[model samples]
Target: MNPERTSAGPILITGASGQLGAALVKGAQAAGLAHRAVQRPAFDFDNPASIAQICAETSPSLIINAAAWTAVDAAETNQDAAWRANRDGPATLAAYAAEQHIPLIHISTDYVFDGSKGAPYIESDQVAPLGVYGASKEAGERAVLSTGAASMVLRTAWVFSAGRANFARTMIEAGRKRPELRVVADQRGTPTAAPDLAAAILRIVALIQRTGWQPHYGGIFHATNQGATTWHGFATEIFAQAARHGETAPTIVPITTQDWPTPVRRPADSRLDGQKLAAVFGITLPDWRDATRRVIADMLTQPASAP
Candidate 1:
């Protein structure tokens, strides 16, 4: 089917309850785009049968797969669940997309890389996932790309939004409760705003609708905000901005990654380059700091006193 108009058919957005999915639904609604956002019992990666059920019900002209098992540390123990969500489910979706001749946009992660590159990662860079979550997502990327469907794997990093349980929210909540907070300083990656990523996805949908799906449009694309920062830096900025709105600014202590150990080793530097996204789709996300400022403002509805 030809992508003549974005509104010509319903756009299917999975993971509707998630941060990015919520943002995509809001963006689509604000843009007046016909779309159906779904999650959980209605459309779950854990329940593979739901995939075809929802697809048939929505009859989506374009599909955006945002549903996935995103708990990083938990994935270590839940390997089967992670693979089912990240790899098998997406593979099934890709196969269906290929069969239906539908265009698909699959959301991916920066974790696919081991983060040893020291510099930013481009779309073509070699993938060496350090954990189960990353490896499963990497497998999903391979599945999507191999399907030969008009699919675009948009890999993003450190996604956060005002409406979800993300780093920013965790920092803000921790900052209010604690007099001092210790944050990981060694790990580096861009903090992509869910709203910004969602808008970018919509722009891609619009572009495809306007120009129709081209042969070159079906591949991986890196889509993160323009800059990078460590978790410590990000937490500091969050408090700095929140302080302006009368929220307490806690003392942030920068600690090494080892100080804050986890079940899996996180990427020391997982920054993704957006040059290809700009060159191809003429799309780019806003700066991390600026996006942080906006999210902080949105999150600080009523400033809470320090504990």
Candidate 2:
């Protein structure tokens, strides 16, 4: 499986406008790593030509594909757009990466699994996406892995950050206006902090940079903060942390999945086992609780932004 690798160049990050993408950009800048981040107009999945143009312009040594159509419910109605962003866009990047012998790191979602599995899922588990969004992402994973490029598909879940619209921010903002909020408790997954995931991605980049591309590094890896909780539990924690900054805590009524139905069917339990990531990359994200605390602090300390 050993293949000749291209010389190192600036890391190219797609979906720069996203929470994870923005965090990656910030992390790269803080670490002083050479990186180029791009979003829509300049680089977009809807515009296939833009992918190649951005790649050519960046001449990236390694690519961290943080781009994807993440709207779970919207995917049901907008299947084509979801496919373009999730599957087609990544396929294009993978093909180009293969042609140039560039290593790629593609971000994926935990939704690939149907959450039928009672326990945490390992990388080798068969994927059974429950909805359009998950199905599109599963297709993207196949495209990236099948290209024969030095690629790693990192499957993460419940990603949030202060930089964008996310669960934590939504909870805080909504709690301020409402006295009580009903959060779905039946669904279970780890809440991954964007900055933590970003830091871990950079660590992988460093490892690849230090040791050169390793064949074993090119595969599926589950990456999430340690521990799992329901959306209800997550909101409770978010409020607990937010309250430290004098924000009011609303009464959170735990509700079932049926109580808060959406267009897409989310996994009942999608906790990803990250032992593979720890063993392979020697990286583990901080616990969700700690990550939540840090993000809440960052959110409060920073200027207010639209959710």
Candidate maximizing TM-score: 2
lDDT of each: 0.90, 0.93
Estimate the TM-score of every prediction. Answer: 0.96, 0.98
TM-score, predicted candidate 2 vs. hidden true structure: 0.98
Q: What are the RMSD figures for all models against the true structure?
A: 2.1, 1.4
Tens digits of per-residue lDDT for model 2 on 107-135?
A: 99999999999999999999999999999
lDDT (Cα, tens digit) per residue for candidate 1, span 1-307: 5542334579999999999999999999999998999999899888878998998888788899999999999999999999999999999898888887788899999999999999999999999999999999999999998997889999999999887799999998887789999999999999999999999999999888777888778899999998999999999999999988888899999999999989999999999999999999888889999999998888776345232
TM-score of 1: 0.96
Model 2 weakest lDDT span, ten residues long: 1-10
lDDT of 2 at 69: 94
